[model samples]
Target: MSGLAKRLAGQTAIYGVSSIVGRVLNFLLTPLYTGRFAPAAFGIITGLFAYMSFLNVVFTYGMETTYLRFANRPGTNRRDLYNRVLTLLLLSSFGLTALLIALAPTLMRLLGIPPGSERYAVWLTLILGLDAVAAIPFARLRLENKAVKFASIRMANIVLNVGLNLFFLVLCPDVLAGKYLSGLAPLLRPLYNPSIGVGYVFLSNLAASAFTLLLLGRELLDFRPRLQVTYLGPLWRYAYPIMLMGLAGMVNETLDRVLLARWLPEGFYPGRSSLAAVGIYGACYKLAILMSLVIQAFKYAAEPFFFAQSEDKNSPRTFALVLKWFTISCTILFVAVSVNIDLIAPRFLTSPEYLEGLPVVPVLLLANLFLGVYYNLSVWFKLTDKTYFGTYISFGGAALTIALNFALIPVLGYMGSAIATLVCYVTMAVVCWLLGERHFPVPYPMSRLLLWLLAAVAVVAGSWALPPLGSWIAHMVHLLITLAFVAAVWLVERPERAFRRTQAKAA
Candidate 1:
């Protein structure tokens, strides 16, 4: 690989290592939650998180990307820019927090939560506020290539969150059961309220977010504080579209859950409630967590990695190669998740009730793959300063997603939501690419990427044709299929040719 590609890969791997470990550790909680909470109760957790996704975008207001975009430009005051961003985000975050906290009671009611559940809203506001402030520092670390420190803080947060979850969800519950820790049952009973069932999870997250802020306090305080109202105009001009695009993207990603619940006809299920349907779909969504994890880690590295190299003469080639490799990686993940989901869903992800929604797993996985591609394609808008294009695309996708869910949820339920998700992503990716071709073409090798996607789908589907061999044999078949994909990428993409071609042109 070329030096830039290798460096990008190295950073992505470093970031990915932490993400992989943290997500795996946290991923264990899927079974813990599914095993513990009833379907409707679990549905409440899903819906809250879905809303959190949107609220987080609103809270940050795309300041993280704004900071990165400005910091790398020529003749800019890096420290001054940092200070302005830090001040704006701090004020906005806390101000937003106050508003949400004051409205917590009303918001809880609107969300269908009981009166006592206002603590959930309060905790969520605090988490988002702190997280928004911390995001700039985290983005700084990415810009400065401080991946090791970044990974450490992320992993530590994960450890604390997961450890606390074990205490609240597993150990405390068991101790209260009088089944294992009968001797300490009296001591722990008051501390572990059975009534706070879902509340415990929220409380644990609150503690973790507070701890992360403590860990990042130095970075937060290090910046020299400043505010220039004049500078605010350009920053907001650049950031507003991004912020809206982010909100709309969240709508595409998360509104499905909200719509799936709200749009369901009153008598859709004779015995099952709409919330119960959400619980099933949400758990099945976890089966695709690996795809989300990979995409997230790539984004953390890709934004800085691409921007830092934007002025390079060969950056287009680099971008093309990155797209190919990332597409290959996503294709592999799709096969792994879709093929093993049978064994995966039953044993660890969730209980039998959730298994009813397993059909949506493959659909969501493929959706995330396209979602990742759209993220890569998004660099065009960011680089060209045509971020409004992103707003348009995301709003377009969100409209389609919302419309599809409303139309189809009563007919097909969660499957309808899943279909909507895939359609939206595909639409966004195609539209973005066509616009990029006209405005900021990047030579994305669309034909090869399509082949890789089709190959992945074909391979995953063909695996089911394998006989009911023993579990070990079936695993071996999957293994061989995965390796075959590796070989195909090597032959078709020809890694060495790109290096040689770039070298020949340079020399």
Candidate 2:
């Protein structure tokens, strides 16, 4: 790898420590949740969180990207830019939180949530506000290459969240019911309310977000609340398109969960309720986190890295190489996990009820892989100040997602939603690449990328076609299949040869 790629990889690893590892820890909570709550009950958590994802996009409003973009410009005052961006974010977050809280009951009713469940909406609103306030500080860390501090803070928050979850969901309940720790019942009784139930999840998240904000105190020390029109005008112009893009992106990403329960016809699944389908879908969706986390870590590192390298004449080739490697890595992960999901799902899901949704795993994995590609392809627009194209592409994807989900969810259930996700992301990536070539062309290895992707799909299909075998033998076979695919990729790419060629060209 080149020095730039090495730096990007190193930064991705640091961010991955928090994103991939921390979220894996967070993802563990799924089994706990699934084991404890029935599918219908868990669906409430799924539905509320899906809405939270959309609200989060609205609350942050693209300032994170805007901050990174403007802060890197020559002659710009980083501190001043941080202060203005953060101040605006804080002000808007507060305003949005208050509005959401006031309308929580009405919103809950519209979403078909039970009447008393408005507290979930209120708590989610607070969480959104806190996270939005902390976003620019987090972005500032990325801009300054403070990956260690960023990772540390994020990991701490995840640990605290997970720890609190165990305390509330397991220990407290077990003690209250005298299952264990009987001696501590008196100590915990007043603090732990059994009626709160899944509300603990929201509380745990809110506390973690608050703690993260506090830990970032130093980043917030210079907040002087500057809102000059001179600064605000350009920032608004640049950010609003990205915000629209994000809003639409969230629609493609989360609206399925939000809509599945409402759109599915009664008795579509025979024994299962629509909410149960949502819960099953949500649990299975966690299986896709491996791909999503990789994409997130890459985005965290690559956004700043891309901006910094924008002036380099060789950056187009560098971008092309990044996408190639990114696709290769994700395809490997997709095949590995999809092929072994039978072994993996039971460990994480812990509930037999969720097994039905397993078919969605590979589809969602491929979808997220495409989403990652779209993120990489998106660099052209971000660098060229044509972010409006992103807005257009994302909205188009959102339309397709909504339409597909509505048309298919009634007939196919959660699998429909998964298929919709795959189609939407694939469409977005293709459209972005097409538009990117016309404006800011990069010589992406389109044929090579498709080759790897098709190869992975074929491997997965072949694994499924194999005759049943003993558990150990099946494991061995899957391992060999994965390894063979990796070896084939290495032999064909001969990355060492490519590296030497790149070096000679640079020299």
Candidate 3:
């Protein structure tokens, strides 16, 4: 492995401590929530978080990336720039929280929540506000290469979050039932509400976010920024475009859940309401979120890694290899999950009611693989200051996403949403790859890469076609098929190793 690749691996490993671990801890909650909550109840929980996903993009307003861009420029005042940016984000987050709290009734009504359930919106509002405030502090850790600190806080947040979820979803219910604390039941009566089932999920998240903000005391309390109008202008100029891209990209990422309740026709599925369908889909979506975690872990490392590598002449080749390896890994993940889902889901992933939408999981996994490739393809635009091209691509994907969701949700329900996700990502990935090659050509091992992808896909498709056997027998077959795909990739890469050796000798 090259030095750069080693560094990338190290950084990715450190960052994964948070991204991967945090996600796993949270992923564990999926089964717990799915087990206890009905499809509609869990769907409400999923829908609320989907809104937060988009809101995080809005609340941060691209300052996360903008800070990175300006902070690294020569002769920049690091402290001043940091203080200035943090101040703006602080005000924005606080103001947004106030506005949402004041208008909770109106906004919750617009979101189609019941009149009595408007407090969920208020809780989510506070959650997003605290997260937005903490955003730059987290980003600063990444910028400073404080990977350990970053990972620590992230682990803390995940542990706190998982612990709270357990207390609310598991212990509280047990306590109310007099399972352990008969005497304390009266004291906990006000804290626990059986009807407020999904509210516990939001409440846990709000407490977790607050704990994180408190941990970053210095960043939160810093108020000595110059508030320079001059600095603000350039940052906005660079950031707002990224913000546009973020908004559009988020639509591609999450709009299905947001719109499903409204766009999914009345009486589409036999007994399930639109929100119920959302819950099923969202629960199944969590099954594929393991792939998403890998993609996210790579992103937290790769975004900065790519920027730093822009000056290296051999970077294009390195990036191409990175894409090849990433595809191979994602393929392995998809096959592993798709094949063993039966064994996995029953054990700890989701409940029986949420299992109905399990078919969408494989499709969503493949879609996320394409999305990962698109992020790798973004090197050209980010390096060349043509990031606005990203905006255009995201806009195109967003349009496609919205149009397809509108057209298909009524007919196919959540399955339509899954298909739309697949199509949108495939389009975006292909578009970005083609355009990036024209503007910033890389010697990508496209042919061999696709061969590995196809092999993995083929093995997975064959697994699907296999006869149903006993549980252990089925798992054995799945394991063999996945291993076969891995071996095929290794065998194909073998000759390339020899060829590289030959080239090295010639040099």
Candidate 4:
């Protein structure tokens, strides 16, 4: 790998330490939640979070990307830019948060939250505000290449989030019930409210977001709350399109969950309420986190790295190589997880009820793979200052996602939602690449990437065709298949050989 690629990889590794570990810790909560809450109840968590995803986009309004874009420019005053972005975000976050909190009752009714649980809306809104306030500081960390500090704060937040979840959802309830530690029940009685039930999940998240902001004290303290119109005008123009794109992108990414309960016809799953179906889909969706985790870590590193390298003459080749390797890495994850999901699902789900949604996992994983590619391809527009294209493409994808969900959910149940996600992302990635070729023209090895993707899918399909065997034997067979796929990939994409060829050409 070249120095630029190595730098990107190293940064990704640092970010991955926090992202992978933090997300894995968060991911571990799946079993805790599934064990504690029924599918119907878990669906409430799923649906609320899907809405928060959209709200989060609106809260920050894409200032994070705008900060990176402007801060990296020649003669730019990074400090001033950071302060302006942070100030704008803080102002907007507070205003939006108050609006949401004041409208909590109406929001609750619209979201189908049971009456008297307005706390859920309030807590989620607070979480969004806190996270939005912290967004610029987090982006500044990336801009400064402070990956270690970034990872540390992220890890701390996840640790606290997980710890509090266990405390509120497990220890407090168990102590109050006299299940164990009866002596501590009196001490915990003030904190333990059984009536709150799943509201604790949102409460835990709220506390964690606040803690993350606190840990970013140094970054926040550096702010002077400046808002120069010269900067703000351009920043607004650059960022609003990104915000629109992000909102529409969230529609593609999460609208399925938000719409599933309402759109799924009655009696579709027999004995399963629409919420129960959403819960099942949500649980299975977690199985795709490995793919997303890789993409996220890549994104953290790639965004800043791509902006920094935009001036380089060789950037297009570098970008193409990066995408090639990124696809390879995700393809490996897709196969590894899909083939062993039988073993993995049971361990994480604990409840047999959720296993029914297992079939959606591979489809979701593949969708995320395409989403990652879209993220990579999107560099062209960001670098070219043509972000309006992103807005257009994302809104187009969102329309497709909504149309497909409406058309498919009633017929195929939650599986329809999964299929819709896959189709939407695939379409967005292809459309972005086609537009990019005309405008930016990176030599992405489309044929090879597609071949690898198809091969991985075939491997997963072939794994399903294997005859039933003992649990241990089946695991062995799947392990061999995974290993074989990895070996084949290594042989074909030998980095050392490519590096030597590049050196020879240079010589």
Candidate 5:
């Protein structure tokens, strides 16, 4: 392997370990959340996070990408650039957080949230602001190629968040019920509701965000404030378009739940059908997104690596090879998830009401697969320094997403949202690949890649033809299906034989 390919592989492993483990830990929380919170509560959780995701992109305003770009520039005083960017982000994010908190009630009402529902808006505002400040250190870690520290911090945050959640949602509730209820009833009586489900989860998140911020203090203190107004013009020129692109991307990804909150039909529940659907969709979406998170962790490390490698002669071939392998692995993941969703779906939300989302799971997984491929391929524009391509492609995807949601939400509701998401990702991936070739071409192995994907999809489709069995039996069948797909890939790739030969020679 070339140096870049080798680096990509190593960072991918580190990223994989952290991402897979963190997601698994977060995955465990889904059951607790679904069991404890009402669907409506989950709706609030979903909506608040959706709002946070949008603001987060805006808060950073494309500085993460800018940092990576400038850090690689010649004689650039990378640390000074880091400090300047970090200071700008910290000041802006805190200012934005304070502003949002003050305007929370008005924003809440404007978004159709109840007047006093500003509680969630407040929590999300602070958390996302802290997250924005934290992004600089995280991006700096990536720039310095500190994948281990990056993964470690991520895992630590997940561990803290998950532990706190278990404490609040499980241990505290039990303690109050068993030992303290009689004594505390006068002052803490409202804490014992078996049903105030989603609020506890959000509270746990707030606590975790505070904890993560504290842990980041050393890195925070290391940076000196240096606002280079001279850098702002070029930075904004580059980052502003990327910010718009990020907004469009987030809308394509998350606008579904927000729109569904309004588009879901009446008679669905007493007063909280939207929340219930949000909980269901959100939980199952987590399952589909596990693969996406893995991709994200890799992209976190991969983007900087790609840009640095662009100056090398062998970069085109190396990038093409990585793209091939990424697609192959991701396609396999999509198959595994689709075939075994019957088993995996229950672990997240076992309720029958939420199981209706099972069918949507496969659609969502494929959409995420497309999304991962798009991100991997997107290095073309970033390398060429023509990031305006990002704005155009993402805007196109967002347009498609909006039009589809508006047209289909009233007709098919949540399912419409799912279909729309899949359509948007597929469209973006295709457009990106087509446009990328014009400026920065790589020899992506389309034929073998399609064969591998077709094999996985065929196995899943064939499995559906069989009669329904018990859950365990169905899981076993799906596992077999996935294993068969993997075996076929190994046979075709012949990686084991080549590895053994290399080992023999080294010995």
Candidate 6:
């Protein structure tokens, strides 16, 4: 194999394993959380995280991508570049953390969350800040090909977060209130607040972020930072469009939660059902995020690799091939989830009310499939430094997302948000493709891509047409059928046959 291809495969495995394992492990928490916490409580969790997503982009100042671009530039002083970036990140993170803490109460009130809940906001602030500082170092790990360590740190954080959650939610509250504490001090028993559910979730995240900081201590201390204006000038220019894209991208992905809370009038659902419905939507969305998981893992390597190896003749062809395989994998996942959601949703969430959001899962899943394709298509602008064009597309998507959610939420509630998301992602993907071809055309296999998509939609229709054999048994049969359909596509696509022929010729 070629060196680039080999590196891509190895790094992809490391990052993919970390993502898949982390997501699967974290997926276990969905059942526990949805079972225990009220919908409003989950909404609180959802809203806070959505808020953090935007803040993270702000806190990092797009330095991660900036680091990748500058660090790979010819004749660049790698050590100086790394140091300056880290130094700037440290200063910026501290400022952002403090700023958030100071503004926490007002911000909470503005978001329609209660005021005394400043503590949750504070936890989120610290976590985001810590994450921002760790961003480039993490990217550095990817750039330096330290995938093992990269994956290791990510797994460790997930483990710590999950452990802390189980302790606070399951073990601590009961143990502290039980015979042991009761015997020691009856008054102390009253102090145990089992009602402190979502707050504890934030606390767990904070503890995990702190632990991650300590674990990355070696990487943190080793890089000695110094700013150079000449390097940063062009670096900032490259990153500005990325920052806009990141900000707009976050808005498209996340602004719905914020808008839903603000736009939807009270009494949308029965007895705070709006919040609960949002939580349900959030959980179901995770099921669809399988596409996102793969895209994320590929992106970590693909972005830097694309930029660094820009001039190579094989780069565009390789991207085209990756895009095709990405669609195929996502198409398989789409069919599996659309067909077997009845089987999976029960394991992932507890309440029957939560299951109402199941229909949204397939819609959101297909949209994300297109979103991943758009990400692959997005390399054109980045490689050519025409990132502003990408930013414009994301902005258009974000505006559509917000406007649709606003107009429809009062009428449709949580489902409106899902529809808006689906529309926005599809729009972004289509627009990116049209504009991208004009700038830097890659040979995407349109016929194969459409075939996979059409086959997935057909499987969805087939699964739906089959009689409901009582939910459980019906779902099982549908899952098997879905797998059969995917296998059929794999046979027709003939990927393995093509691979063997290429190898034989090379030999």
Better of 1 and 6 by lDDT: 1
lDDT of 6 by residue, 1-507 (tens): 345755776787789887878867877888878888877789888888998888888888678888887777789877777898898888888988898899999998888785568889988999998888889789889888888999999889988999888877766665675734435445444544565657888888899988998889988998886766776688788787888889999988888888887787889876765666667778777788777887788888787778877888877667776777678878888888888878888888887767877878887888888888888889888888788998899899999999999888999887788889889988898898888789888877777788779878888877878876986689679868987987797687676774675467548
Q: After superposition, how far is residue 15 of candidate 1 from its true place, in Å?
A: 1.3
Q: Candidate 6: what lDDT? A: 0.81
lDDT of each: 0.88, 0.93, 0.84, 0.93, 0.80, 0.81
User: Per-residue alpha-carbon lDDT of model 4 for 370-421, expressed as tens digits?
Assistant: 9999999999999999999999999999999999999999889889999999
Query: Cα miss at 183, model 2 (Å)?
Result: 0.8
Better of 3 and 4 by TM-score: 4
**CA error at residue 389 for candidate 4, angstroms:** 0.8
Badly placed stretches (over 4 Å) of model 2 are: 501-507
Question: What's the best-to-worst order under lDDT?
Answer: 4, 2, 1, 3, 6, 5
CA shift of 82, model 2, Å? 1.0
Give me candidate 5's TM-score against the actual structure.
0.92
For model 2, state the Cα shift of residue 211 in Å: 0.4
Worst 10 residues of 2 by lDDT: 497-506
Instruction: Give the TM-score of each candidate.
Output: 0.95, 0.98, 0.95, 0.98, 0.92, 0.93
Compute the lDDT for candidate 3. 0.84
Clashes of each: 0, 0, 0, 0, 2, 1
Q: Please, what are the lDDT tens digits per residue for candidate 1 over residues 257-344?
A: 9888888887676678988888888888888889999998899899999899889988887888788788888888898778877667
By TM-score, how accurate is candidate 6? 0.93
Whole-model lDDT for model 4 versus the true structure? Answer: 0.93
Q: Mind giving the per-residue lDDT tens digits that candidate 5 earns over 189-219?
A: 5544545455566666777777777777777
- In model 3, the runs with Cα more than 4 Å from the true position are 181-187, 218-223, 494-507
Off by over 4 Å in 4: 501-507
